[model samples]
Target: MRIAFVSFETVYHRDTETSQRFRTVCELFAARGHDVNCYCAGFWAGEESAFERNGVTYHAVSSGTEARSSFLLRLPFVLATASPDVIHASAQPSSQVLAASWGSTLARAPLVLEWYGDDGVSDTRWSRLATGRPGRIVTPSELVGTWVREIGADGDIVDTVPNPIDCERIHRVEPGEAVDVIYARRLDEGANLESLLLGLAELRGRDWSAKVVGDGPERETYERLARDLRIEDRVTFVGDLDLEERIAAYRGAHVFAQTADHCVFPTEMLWALAAGCVGIVEYHANSSAHELVEGWDRGFRTTSEDELAEAILAAGDLEHREYDEAFAEYDRSAVADRYLELYRTLQEAQGLL
Candidate 1:
């Protein structure tokens, strides 16, 4: 399969979750022997129009990351020249989707938009028009899929393909020292750590300890909150950790609590669940974290701090596990297969397969 990805700014240009997700899937597709080419503003050093790394080829639509109008104008012609079987694109800077649409039409390829919905993308006239242009829209969660539908995209064309997890790594890493509770995510304004802190404060008399496994601008604020709550002694603020360290923490922890106020997909929570932690998610209007725990036996969904506290306590009764096989479907390979399936379906529909 020849796959073309269109994103003016990639993970190299900006290290946002949406960018990382796009690059991860692109590399995964390339690893599976698909011919993958990414069209973006070049981020590599030197004066090269194209660069190859990690089994993927990246073509520069612009020499550097500047002048959005120039990138938009060049992208369509560049994509048409590549002539890939399918065109995958990021949904930010929605005008790019429109440009990709023109390119897909010229290249006689199907266009699939990956919409993470976490970047606070505002709806402009161009974005509203672009929403309806993609042949298919892929979101990480149904919550995001629904958002796409509301913003003029056809619901019939929207599908949810979750973020992938490295299941083998989870199985390989040994559990770290055991703890009663765990919370992991960047401590940004949306972290909502207070929910978990308040919940834990209620259970102060209980013999429980927690580890916060991330760092961000709001880390000090959360640390101060823990101190004020007087649970600082029990909660350890172990800033951001590498994947292995995080997996170890998840494996050793009995319960993993997610209280973020905004989340397109709960990637960390999924990791913890795969590590065998009983999941406790606080429901929020903008977050899809609760979607992961809805019907799972070892998962609990709470609407309030009291319910969150109760769920944490209830998780104590579940047997501790070092790894869970139920999340195998979300393994990186499996998720890549989902994208491949979608690509084939679209290609066949267009008589390109």
Candidate 2:
């Protein structure tokens, strides 16, 4: 099948979790001998107007020093070049999904809009209108799915597919390199990494190490807070590292601690599972963290500060979760298999199969 994956975000932004997820999906399809093309807004150096990377084709769209003012003008060229069977979109009603809608109409392709983040759905009112157009909407979790349902999308047209991870990259190593708990997020204040520091401070006598990976607007604040907590020596703010280092940290460490903003973000949840760490996720309203923790007995969840502290204290037993090899059946290969089935379903439903 000929598939065009569209994102308005520049390829410079492709290094992020959401973009990497899409890239994994594209590679999945490509590995199976499907024709795949990626359309991204170009902001990279000397990438041409458009080019193909690996087996996948990338069409570049121009922009000003600011936002994409030329998207309407550029849409015609992209759609004409990549006449595709499916236009699977990422994020909300940005130029990405809008281009998907336009491409579906002109190129006669089915549309699949994948929602990675909750901000557009949770904050903006305009998100309601442009999102209503796509042929199908896909979300990574029941939390986002429930929101889409509330927005009154056709129940059958919208479905849930967990975010894809490159399992090979996170494939496990030896017994372990260190006895530390890992917290890897953008380290922003609202993400509540400070509270994590406080909790760790409260447990300094436990003789545990904390490997904090990531840099953000709150790095200096978190560093100062760690120092004040007198746990700064134990906590290593290893600055920001690449994806490989992050995954290696997850593997080398004994546990995963994510006190995400109420755990509404699903990327960390998926990463925790993929990293083979027995995770302790934060619970809050609009959170699917508990959903990831449910029934698996492979992970734990806590919301309160006391509960988080307790989890931190007990994070040493990362192996007791009885590593679910059964769940490994749902890894990238399994997910890609499912997506191929979905694509074939689309083809057969349209009698093109």
Q: Indicate which candidate wins on TM-score.
A: 1
Any runs in candidate 1 off by more than 4 Å, and if so which? none
What's model 1's TM-score? 0.97
Backbone clashes counted, model 2: 0
Query: Residue-wise lDDT of candidate 2 within 1-353, one digit each (tens)?
Result: 88888776633564655666677778778887889887767655684776666577776665432456566457646776678877787764355566567777787677777776545364345456556767677776778777777766677877777766666555653333564677877866556787677777778887888888888998899899888889988888898877666766666666677776644445654665666677777776766667777776657788776787888667665463213354465577788877767766766676665
Compared with the true structure, all predictions reach lDDT values of: 0.91, 0.69
Model 2's C-alpha root-mean-square deviation from the true structure amounts to 3.5
Note the clash tally of each candidate: 0, 0
How do the residues 1-353 of candidate 1 rate in per-residue lDDT, one tens digit apiece? 89999888999899999999999989998888999999998899988888998988999898877778889999999889888999999998888999999999999999999998887445678767878888889999998888777768788899999999999999899899899999999888899999999999999998999999899999999899999999999999999899999999999999999999999999999999999999999999899999998889999999899999999989999999989999999999999999989999999999986
For each candidate, what TM-score against the reference? 0.97, 0.82
